[model samples]
Target: MSFSLFRASVRRAATAPRAQLRSQLRIPLRKFSTPPPEAPVPTPKSNTTLYVGIGAVVAAAGVAFYSFSDSGSNAVKTGVQAAKVKANFVPTKEDYQKVYSRIAGIFDDAGDYDDGSYAPIILRLAWHSSGTYDKESKTGGSNYATMRFAPESQHGANAGLNVARDLMENIKKEFSWISYGDLWTLGGVAAVQEMNGPKIPWRPGRVDGVQTQATPDGRLPDASQGSDHLRKIFGRMGFNDQEIVALSGGHAVGRCHSNRSGFDGPWTFSPTTMTNDFFKLLFDEKWVWKKWNGPKQLEDKGTQSLMMLPTDYVLVQDKIFKKHARAYADDEALFFKDFAASCAKLFELGVPTEQWVSPEPWIMKNVDEK
Candidate 1:
């Protein structure tokens, strides 16, 4: 009744239920080993529930997206609209002519400015704003109205440019369609032309860019720099020997302020006039090192009132620059032509070829001429 019966019971359990238990384990293994049965292909009759379930998921996703994205969506839409408004605006040449004449009317009434005119400083605004261009990176320049950003405005080179910019702001209010780049540059042109200088062929269509697009400081030529540095800075702008000589003629107008440029005094006797006088002075005068508590600069030996940047002195020291400088000095007409071309080039720097307001620049008639 003990061992024999126990053995018989074990054999019965193994043969009968044990095989079934093994079969059950194998069934699970085989089920996993093979692919589970294909999901039943949705039948037309069954698709209603399936479609309803899918539609519910999609609708929920749509609601979630709309709720979360509302602010961002509105921002994008507003930005696009603002861009469109800017794009559609096309100020006529006549409208610009009005701006050109109006800017000519703004002179130094306060007697607080240099040369008894805001014209010189106004010209410098165009100069500094457009001067930031790098033909390589195509950054800087007036295209961004970049001086409006503090980073460019704070640069020592651009120190007093706010006076120029603020003067133009009055004009900006009247002609809202005009970009600051165009206004400032046009002001430069008008200053030259109205001051009895050459006709600066001008155009518009510089779009305002943001602060991220602002060029880093020191791109403008340091008055402290020599010929080699001038070559590196201006050459980067694609200016040639003749162009550099011509551009220096802008010194004919503006004065260097100790508070602004850290160098004080006018370049020529007539700081109000843009002329070959700068070239004449560059060649004909004696420039002695200025002895001052301020930054190092050169004073005209005969008259300590005038100043010359080292970069300016380089024009004569470098033979290539001297030739053009002498040529511009010899012929006032030639100086006017080259200076006009250089001003046009400087204003156009960093502007994409396609972005110009005109295919060929306009020779805006001076108020007297008009």
Candidate 2:
């Protein structure tokens, strides 16, 4: 069985920036539902959200239009000028590749990061940044890199993600035309592929978020919950059982920090690399409730070193979730295919399909792939 890995060839020439398309079409969702008529007092902890500065030019149409509210009442909004943003120059695929290299290069260069690489945190930034989408209200998701501001920044689920954001911000300085939504998600794809994970199809068009556009906290999954909660949370984003398990494969990479999530330990031995190991170990190992002062979590009875959250444990306990979990453990190839498709959907949660510039999202070549 082959791992399907690729190393970068000498950098290749990228296509020129394409023409910008201006649409008179009004976005279906009313930008942001005008803040409720009886809005509460704007406290420091109230509606304010975040926007990390990343300039994005449309790769397809070439326009710099960001979806969501044009008004300041939005919970999470982009700071980019709503009017057409002129780039110092039009961005080409080469521009994006430079960004991919930079994201890949950070892992080798960062001396102060986890697992000797920035892969894990970068995935979290992509997940947390995009996980906020609520299909019901048509709010949240990666469209606006809303986690940069308040309330959302200090949210429990987003704890420690500032590290990932700070890292991405450094890249934003170099590529001013890429949106934070696109850049961070691309960083996620880079981290996964470089770490030997699947190739996730990523597209650009995310606008930067504004302070007022921030979504309320508590939207992310809580490790303390069970299968019902899993459905409730991911379900809100419109994810089903199969997609939920596939996304959880991400835990194959990155350990929980005692200081950050309060839960501790790696789910798989190779936390910096992606593998079916998360599922393999989930079935192969004997897990027992971790005896700890921190919080109620699971420890592998085989070796007390590895950990699983109450949430992860439920995947096997529940009948429906267990079925999918076992399928992944049995077949790495199946897991990879499903994980790629689910993740591609995960990143595009709140984005309107029509807004995407490319009819087929681009599969960016990995640093290893020529």
Point to the candidate with the largest lDDT: 2
- lDDT (Cα, tens digit) per residue for candidate 2, span 258-335: 677777777766666678988998899999998879888898887687778888888899999899999999999999
> What C-alpha lDDT values do all the predictions have?
0.66, 0.67
- Residue-pair clashes per prediction, in order, are 0, 25
Model 2 local distance difference test score: 0.67
State the TM-score for model 1: 0.76
Q: How many clashes does the backbone of model 1 have?
A: 0
Question: What local lDDT does model 2 show for residue 168?
Answer: 87
Query: How many residue pairs in model 2 have overlapping backbones?
Result: 25
- Per-residue lDDT for 1-370 in model 1, tens only? 0000000001111112323533543421110011222322233232233333333332343344334433454233324424433343234566677788778777534253444567777777788787778877767777657777667778877776677778888877666545667888999898888666899888765765555567888777777777888777788888888888888887776667666666666676655556788889988898999998987778887757677777788899998989999999999999999889988989888876656645678889777663
TM-score of 2: 0.78
Superposition error at 208 for model 1 (Å): 1.0
Best by TM-score: 2
